[model samples]
Target: MKTFISSLLLLFSFNTFAAPKSELWSYWNVSNEKNATTISHQYWQQTLDKYLITRGEFTLFDYAHVTDADERTLNSYLRQMSRIDPREYKKSEQYAYWVNLYNALTVKLILMDYPIESITKLGGLFSFGPWDEEIITVAGKALTLNDIEHRILRPIWNDPRTHYAVNCASLGCPNLQPKAFTARNSDKLLDKAATEFINSDKGVLIKEENVQLSSIYDWFAIDFGSQQQLFEHLKKYRPELKPFKGDIRYDYNWKLNQQ
Candidate 1:
């Protein structure tokens, strides 16, 4: 009986709380055509420029060497972001705002608990990760990392490419770009991110008759629409990647993408 109960608890934590789907936080659905203000991400960019290192297929952040001044810069950027209501800006501008903020918050989270092997370790005995913890307050709402990614960005944007823009601070996730996202260059950034991730073995590796994909597709299957759609999405990035009738596999790395 104890064994069964333990198993149930594990399942409850991993299966129920781990993956959150895209549901529109309807309050953020509004956008302003009048607001053409370009929000500056220079502070966030400065941190990335100073600490992000491109290592082979993925990038690692040097969380250990972050100076006190730079950490203050990160926190200042987060504070500036949280004060503004995204609904007051155009969706294009809002996209970059939310993406940059999400990535910055994730990096800060890892820094708070530096020296950890995996983010899963921060989840304690029964939780999957720190994703559920309210890490930032934005527009008067206390939001979690999951809330930023799954709620605001995913639903408002309705673009699968969004998965590439927000970094999860994991080796298996998309590369954390050296430059912070911006309104003027966000679309281009998305396409570039998709291309880079798709071409890399971490995203898709075609071995003879089999196609191996990152678990992002499997986890966010709803975003990709279907298996056929996923294949099409892959081909969009890598034109040389011909469709195969072989088995498809999904895998991911949960280790902290730390330097």
Candidate 2:
């Protein structure tokens, strides 16, 4: 009976009842030049058309399983990161590494669970959410989300745009760019992310003289340029908004980003 019970427990652990993950590196190709779009506007239209973001969308994840491609891709990226000696990276590679890890691990999390209500829903004690996993082995060392963010991203690359590229799978989160991150165009990609989000109704609010906005601007106000710079940045894309005088309030919907 004890043996049978152990076998049942093992089976349950391996059950196929979990969320589905987003496909990775399938055809995503980020530009290597600054100011060049990470993903073309047309591609954004095509991809989003199929995977529209709606409320209450949930994706369950399996913390235990990973595909060969998933493993290979993450390992490849992380390995490339490891190869850059820290001294050189501070001058060049660190920012790219941080963004790459942020993006790569996000993809890994989606793959493991396939479908989750939101990335934040992966709970744990203290700093041990689903973000804390040794899922990807780099140079034979296991790395988790916390390691990527706290240890790698924050410490090395102090740039504010790091916050924009890492998607937490929420409505309030920045829009996910449909391409891989590389050092070549990191500056441009970050700017685009900032621009797109700032102009988005989801990010900014313009409703009949009553404008509510995303708290992201407040949370990472430092990232949106300076106080006056924020409005200036918006003017480039939303000239009409330049004239609108309305109360600015931030709205953040933390529900899962579902299709």
Candidate 3:
């Protein structure tokens, strides 16, 4: 019975029931001029600086250490983010807004049930992750973490680096950036994030005839295009990765990314 249940959970985790495609919600595909306005992520930045702890390659959030005051501050930041309409801003600002909002909400969700073992354990027996749960309403459109990541960011930006920027609150996922993203620093942060994750063990590790890769590549294979394209993407960040064609495997860790 235990083995059967474990197999079921694995299938659920690996897109048997959760295949989110990069389909744009046309309502949010609009954007204003590049310099039309500026949005500040200072509160989010402050929150990250206070809570993120770097342990080697993994930067964990101090979920256990968050204070009432800090939680209030985070809630306030989230409320402020929800009030604004991102489509009125330029694509760069919108990019930062969506990424920050997704991450902040994820943190908030974790705190709501802290001390949990993994994010996949949320929502009960059949729950794989809280990704599809409707958490907030923006512009009168109810949204989920999946909505933000797959529908808005991925389709609009059409950048594979979107995977690197929007963290999934898991150890195998890319780092929850220590600094909040902004129009001014989004590009640089995205580049740095891509470089870091791709070179790490979670991204790509080649050992003789066997190669292991993060499930991000497998899940979003369309984003990276093809096997050859993925190799180029990995090689762009980690030049030491030599060309190889051999046994390949994909894995992900779903443990809560906390200290």
User: How well does candidate 2 score on lDDT at residue 39?
Assistant: 21
| Overall local distance difference test of candidate 2 | 0.54
Best by TM-score: 3
* lDDT top scorer: 3
- Per residue, candidate 1 scores C-alpha lDDT tens digits across 8-94 of 876877676546888888988889978979888999989988999888887999999999999999999999998888889888888
TM-score of 2: 0.58
Reference-based lDDT, each prediction: 0.87, 0.54, 0.89
- lDDT tens readout by residue for model 2, 1-259: 9998866654653353222222222111222333322221232223323343333222212223444654565555555554533323233344555565565566556555656655654544222137656656544446666566555564445565666677766667776665445556767888877677767777777777677777766666654667577677667656766654567787777555554
The estimated TM-scores of all candidates read 0.93, 0.58, 0.94
Which regions of candidate 2 are displaced past 4 Å? 1-72, 79-86, 125-159, 225-227, 243-245, 256-259
Candidate 3 wrongly placed segments (more than 4 Å): 1-17
Question: Candidate 3 lDDT, tens digit per residue, 1-259?
Answer: 9999898787876555445899999999988875577888888888899999999889999999999999999999988888898888888899999999999999999999888988887665667788889998888789999999999999999999989999878999999998899888998999999998987888877777799999889889999988999999998889888877888898888888889
RMSD of 1: 2.5
Candidate 3's displacement at residue 3, Å, is: 8.8
- How does model 3 fare in lDDT? 0.89
Worst 10 residues of 1 by lDDT: 10-19
Better of 2 and 3 by lDDT: 3
